[model samples]
Target: MDDARPPRARHRPGAERWFRPPDEERRGPAGTRPPWLSTLLVTAVVLIGSGFAGRNQPQRVPLDHVGYALLCAGGVLLLFRHRFPRTVTCGTAAMTAGYLAAGYPYGPVFAITALGVFAGIVGGHRRVAWAALGGLWLSHLVLAHWLYAWLPPAHDHAAPWGQELIVTAWAVAVVAVSELVRVRREQLAKVRAERAAAARRRADEERLRIARELHDVLAHSISVINVQAGVGLALLDDDPEQARTALTTIKAASKEALGEVRHVLDTLRAPGDAPRSPAPGLDRLPELTEQAKGAGLAVDVTTEGGHTALPPGTDLAAFRIVQEALTNIVRHSGSRTARVLLRYGPRSLEIGVDDDGPATTGQGEPAGGGNGLVGMRERAAALGGTVEAGPRADGGFRVRARIPLAAPPGRATGTDTVTPDATEEES
Candidate 1:
């Protein structure tokens, strides 16, 4: 049941190439037909059409045949209007003037000539086109007068003047439409190019931001592993049992770091990959509070209003804000007690983290010089939210973030929490 057929030859040996010259060696003589033969074909059509229209004119001139020939040739050159507008226009103008002066039948033939001249002028120059229009009208006026006088029946001379005005207006209309099309095309191209460039710039910035995040995540975790390993090595010679415990902590930390690294790498490898794991959210504050406690920081968690699950971005922002705030406490706060309060309200969620540690006593010495606060602010700002951090009035540092609970733009929620922690004026 084979239905396949043999392929046929695409070309004949002796015939000219369908679209190209047969003589591969003969690059035609200079000024001969161009590689784009279509241009030549179009020129032939324009010339022949205009020529036949002109040849049929019943006009009596001493060199009527010569005028007709020149008109046909000029029409052919006019086909190059877009390519060499000025040259074609000037040549066509000369030929048309010659045809009119040779006493062609004025009405129908003059109309065709006027159209050709109009094309040339629009393609050439606006001022020149208008000037040519005026000149042609004057010529027609004079010719009409001659015809009126020569004909047996009297003809109205005013009639020809009105006709001249109408033709001139048509020429002006053509010029306006052509210029409008050209201008619109240029504007469209510019807008498209600008938009494309802007998109590319945004993509590059996103990539750079991702790179920075990956570096931050790796550096922080790896640094912790390094410090723990060093401590374990030092203790190994003195207290083997304690060293083993530190080694176990190191193993756990390294494994967690490897998972985070793999998640980041996989995201980079396949852009369409799903979320690695749900990002930490406000509901996980208890776990975070415990982690801080484990790291030897005393923390108190307070809730005000009944809490509800939040939008993913808002939840993530709240969690990170608290995490960074706690990290700062451990790193900078020499205090034994820190407090985290989550306040959920009708419009927004307010998070406040504070530590009653005495301020570090130096300029440019971050009580914990770092980007923790900066990270918190950035996360909030991305969600049309805001955050503030400064030393508390009484004594200590405080960090607060406000995240809107309103679902981001196009989402709906039916069963979300209604209230947040309501603690005020704590001692």
Candidate 2:
């Protein structure tokens, strides 16, 4: 004989979904546990306390089978308080009223009712909790009046009005505590969200800064290599000596670029390695101009107003702006001559780069659509400075930057000091 039973429901990958409450009734908030565990704990305590108190009642009224059954059912219903808080609260309240009306002994059954009310309020059901509380109050009033009429005259220990006042005060206290907890949880959640957003913003800024640094380094070096390679190819058949010289320039430029790129990459690697090379600054501008000259641009450098100290960050930004301007001149400007002017004022440093090349649509426009200018502006703005780039009326392009000398508040004035180089790169 084949035994037959309904086929067991298939347990799929997300089988737990079958047991989970609806999304709306799941929990108090995101990242919190479902309230089932807490509800079960509360039910256990109330059930045990009711049993103990029922045994200790002084003026015990006989509890019939129906009364005992109602008490047990009320305790079990508390297990679903979080999922159906209002319904559970009202059900417990009605059961308590029925037990008292049937002349069962007073016990901790009211404690279970109070737990339901608290659960309802904390589970975000304020209106329903209030309604349940009202219904409970009315039921108590009727129960109290009925007992007064039915009990022996000498056995009435307290006035029904005074007992009602005590119960009302207890309900108010539960509501107040639940409201406080809810407000605190909400505040903590808001703070976490703000912290996450701030972290993301900082991460984005750091990424942009890294991208700008990589672009400036690679673009300048690659443009020099490109020009030198073309020169080598052009002179290969006509002037072998000049062609060899161009190849040498390409080799040196590639080596320096690779070193700088390696230094930057090492910073992202694990610590405990050799100390990093010093970052390039104003002192490196002469070498920069020489490299530009090797790539076939006639470069001139001039200084006025005397040199002054600068913060490391400001020094780095200034060097990068000039480097980017010269790179643009070599790659875009048709003219072969470029001039760099450095003016040190009492409160600021002015850097200007101008190339004698006609302004054209794509000429002097940084590759990838003006990201170079955007990076330059971001760097200057971070140091409370400004940069201007445009075509001169006479037909060439000029880029000027003004950086404040005064250090920003709370900024350290230590190892980042800028000093003028005693020797310049030979033309």
Q: Model 1, stretches more than 4 Å misplaced?
A: 1-41, 60-159, 208-216, 219-223, 226-234, 283-299, 330-337, 357-372, 393-395, 407-427
Worst 10-residue lDDT window, candidate 1: 418-427
- 197-258 in candidate 2: lDDT tens per residue? 65565455555666667878998999999999999999999999999999999999999999
Q: What is the C-alpha lDDT of each candidate?
A: 0.56, 0.71
Candidate 1 to native Cα RMSD, angstroms: 12.2
Please report the TM-score between candidate 2 and the true structure: 0.77
Give the per-residue lDDT of model 1 (tens digit) for 251-327: 76567657766765666666555656765477777766655554456789898897887877677667767776776
Please report how far candidate 2 places residue 324 from its true position, in Å.
Answer: 1.0
- List RMSD in Å for every model shown: 12.2, 11.9
TM-score against truth, every candidate: 0.63, 0.77
Angstrom error at residue 138, model 1: 7.9
In terms of lDDT, model 2 sits at 0.71
